[model samples]
Target: MILEVLQLVPHPDTPAKAVPSVLCSLSWQDAGHWVAGFIVGAPSEALALPTPTRPARTDGLWQRTCFELFLRDPESGAYLEFNFSPSGEWAAYRFDGYRAGMRPLELADPWITSTDRDQFNAGMGAHLAALGLDPASIGTLLSTPMPEIPGAPAAPAQYVLNAHLEDPALGAAKTWQLGISAVIEEADGTKSYWALAHPEGKPDFHADACFALEMAMSR
Candidate 1:
């Protein structure tokens, strides 16, 4: 596997650190095509938690490879950590945060095997089952309009919002009006797409970042 270094940025928040602020972009390229890759960067000084050996799949569009640094709290033997997905999502994990004696909650979804259609279906099926939902009933529920979440105003079927990007090292920045969408994919391999936008901007510091992608065939 050939992994190319696309971009690198020094850490702005911390100085005198051996690991200069780093930002990298990577992609999988084969047969003269770029499949998908994401940006990875160090977010803070806190140690990273151990990454799970089993990868997770989300929405069937992207695959993620992750790495973390783990730290421990002396008093409780419990710890807090930072996690980075090569696909660009960063999150903080606390062993005990929300409820008493509960496991940490993942704030984002990182899906793998986007190009493998069959695996995608199976992954989605497993997700639905975990939700205690019957895949067979999704169709009927979609046909009937449902009420909005309590205390929230109803929104249009579609929505739009502004997006922005900022990075001091690269001297790069962007502002744009964008649309959001969502879709449902059935067990039979059908899909639906929708659009909506959030008030917050989606910032990507590694937009132009680049990296090499390769797979090991055989010995």
Candidate 2:
């Protein structure tokens, strides 16, 4: 039997052991528009997520291939989870506690806004400062237009950060923390979970103990 591989999940396995799944990533523009990027090398005929004729709020989407978002308010201690199936069907739930006080939440697709160079850099600097970092300690910010690179995506979803972070929240990582994830469904109806960082022993997207991807802002 011949099996094709999907690049949606950033598995640690070698290409030889890579399974049929998609590699998914997401980027949000400072609470503006959030966009998801999926690296699906395998053709639809080979591997496809569930897509319904009419997209609607439906349950059991997670049992299949689906995109998800988890947002939380640190002050209010309330959070929301959103599920989006490739089929256009979606669902959302609100929780006042971990796996508690479940309720339905309404939402619409957020616009995908382009990040301007200046605005992006300024936001970066502001966030660093908010974390009590000296402006001089930070590396030189991107001050000019970036030259094109080979094999670069037609549109990039992530930013190229060359600065180092020295905070308790982020000891030295060079990326933002936000909650984003996906479940890739196999032809036989199996699934695997993927996220920015799964700290728990098992797959738990709602694990607010850490961030999948957190939005940063300046006061």
Candidate 3:
């Protein structure tokens, strides 16, 4: 499993008036599951969060305060986007390249939970397979070999397994550039855009430059 602890910075022109910080954690398990957790460093009453409701796939969650995840294939430039609301609503979209050819990414419902108006969590099942990857191929990729390094000690078996997870020859199923972002709205209606990185000009969560985090996946 690969785990990342990350922080989101507000876009230079759009600063949070009430939210002090946004810290996030992402974990990718070998079983093809993903869990994302976020801590909004402010009282729930201070933000204009969505009303709680039954968990379901919904659109336009980004219009207000919402957490998001972006996964891109570096080689083909294809990507997927997910929006998670504190109210248990969510959305998923796939792009052909960059932000082109968008369509819903169908999958089983993800489990979501929130607490204390400060913490939010979303858990998703085998999304790699849902993204059109063959289950058998993923198992093979996990065992792929790594090239030898001259004058360097041999890597452990597990290290080799992780290193080759990004082999492009195997296709987009194995590697990804990740982006974590959020649209935060204060109770009084002030809004801020937070992301790992932002492009100059406007707050475009779909910007390629914002997908700053990288991941190499195994089985």
| Best-matching candidate per lDDT | 3
Per-residue C-alpha lDDT of model 2 across residues 1-81, encoded as one tens digit per residue: 111222333423212122444454444333433455555434433434454334346888788766676666665556767
lDDT of each: 0.28, 0.50, 0.71
Candidate 3, residue 161: Cα displacement in angstroms equals 32
lDDT for model 2, please.
Answer: 0.50
Tell me which of candidates 2 and 3 scores higher on TM-score. 3
Q: Write the per-residue lDDT of candidate 1 for residues 159-203, one digit (tens) a residue.
A: 111111111211112211111122222223332221121222232
TM-score of 1: 0.21
- Give per-residue CA lDDT, model 3, range 21-112, as digits (tens): 88777776542477787777787778887776666789988998888888888888888888888776778788998679999986556656
Cand. 3 Cα-lDDT: 0.71
Give lDDT for model 1.
Answer: 0.28
- Model 3: lowest-lDDT 10 consecutive positions: 158-167
